[model samples]
Target: MSADPTLQVSVLLPVYNAGRYLPEALESILAQENICFECVAVDDGSTDDTADILNDFARRDARLRVLSRPNTGIVGALNDGLALCRAPYIARMDADDIARPARLARQAAYLDTHADCVGVGSWVDYLDPEGEHIWTWKMSANPAQIEHDLLEGGIGGLVHPAMMLRADAIRAVGGYQAECKDIEDYDLFLRLLEQGHFSVLPEPLLGYRQHPASINATSNRGARTAIANRLMAEARQQRGLPEKVLTPTPATPESSQLEWIDLALLDGNWRSARKTTCRLFRSVPLKTAPWQALGKLIQAALGKLRIRAGRIRQFVSIF
Candidate 1:
């Protein structure tokens, strides 16, 4: 370990209604190894006992610092924390998630080795409140791969709770944007990509908690998708891409696959549906590997085309 004080890192965690799991989350950070860091916990006017929990923890540990303020939502809270951060590097941790013991150490090591890499995350194992492992999402090990994947989806592809980056780099990109507040991490990653590469550790170093009240679980997916589509449009404009490319086309050759899969299944075209389903199964691996594959196979077997034309006509006539 380098005995350099300038390498100190600041861990910023913005708290909302996170009373249920805040203690465990805080404990995870306190247990981190091989890193000299400060923990900044900002309470975003949580109506729950979140503030009380933060106070109790702050009293116990000198390393843990707490900021209590009115709720301005996550984006505001994060930006506030960002402005207050004094360390050279900043890491993000959600109040409801658990960071593996090596989370900080690993991220700090990577940033130290590759000074050009602005940000780094790691593969994560999703867990429920009781700490049961539900699924895993792998992330990009190379920053270039992350950027390419972002064009298709979001770079830092599947972001985890344990993310570390250069504070200055984030500031340079104008911090986080409110327009993309809901998808702030993705937006920040895009901006960071312009400055330097962002990569993730191959091994799972973060245990992300998935609860009913979590942002991803509670937010409307349709609305988020719409917002993401808009961001893509704006991003194209920023990059000077053609107007045609800037506008989201009506399902490209890539999306056509999904359309065909739906049509095949509805038309009871088992062969076609099976082939398309197989293509999807091969392309994307689900978290529940066995269950998802089995369900897809069953759907392929019972393709909608299996229904007789006469029965369909009779049902339609009755309606």
Candidate 2:
């Protein structure tokens, strides 16, 4: 239930030096159609005008409220925001990302109907630095798919920012823990999966900005890998899964490079995508999926239309 009769979701937007993109992010939330939600934006000790920007927006729109505190990183901001949520559901957002207009309405409707699911996410449209590279990420659409894919070490088959979770399910796990900093969202998703059903929609509901200076960009990779591995192992054990770590199947560099092509296409960098496609074809010409993907990439390059480019990415890979 909401503190206000109109509220159906509480958007948790944590900011830290994201002054440049905060307004567009907030505008996206405020423009949401047929969605009654309150944005609980935490400044998280930003040294830039991030706080002032949030405060200005809050004054203009009652739906958005700003909070400021020390720069304790995303984990602290998430925990604080969770405690302040008045709605039955919580939706995650970032200062630098833009949410789709119907994101909250669709996710809210999904959670309201799917009682067994503790949380749900949607595939996100990834944006490159120049914003020309627009691509969509595919995530597991149901609990069964996620259960099978969770064995992989990266991304964990879920796009964190596009997610909305049940209030009770989040509280059950005591919210985001401090030590799980880099991989907290992944860790919590696993825990929630164990507790109840979780799923994702096929639609690209959020625009995730990719830049070099984001927090995850600078995280200690070794430390994050260690924590993610430990958390996944623990979750598997809790679910009575086998102990052996699953090799992501087909361990070739081409397999890895194919992922790069996906990113290149997403960033709308056809030159990179085309080059990577050629390399993959030369290396693994017999791979049928690569062949299909490469054909699409070539077609995308010839067209040079953003819509076609976006459409081409939908078939980038099966992984």
The best candidate in terms of lDDT: 2
lDDT of 2 by residue, 1-319 (tens): 2355567999988888988888889999999989889999998999999988998999999989888999998899989888888888899998788898999999999999999988888988776444434456777686877766765555545777888999878999889989999789888887777568778888989988865455455556667777877877887777688775433233244444555567777666776566656665776789864686676686666777777777778768544
Largest TM-score belongs to which candidate? 2
lDDT: worst 10-residue window of model 1: 245-254
Name the runs in model 2 displaced over 4 angstroms.
245-262, 266-319
Full-model lDDT for every candidate: 0.73, 0.78
* Local error of candidate 1 at residue 25 (angstroms): 0.2
> Candidate 2 local accuracy as lDDT?
0.78
Per-prediction TM-score = 0.73, 0.78
Candidate 2 worst ten-residue window by lDDT: 246-255
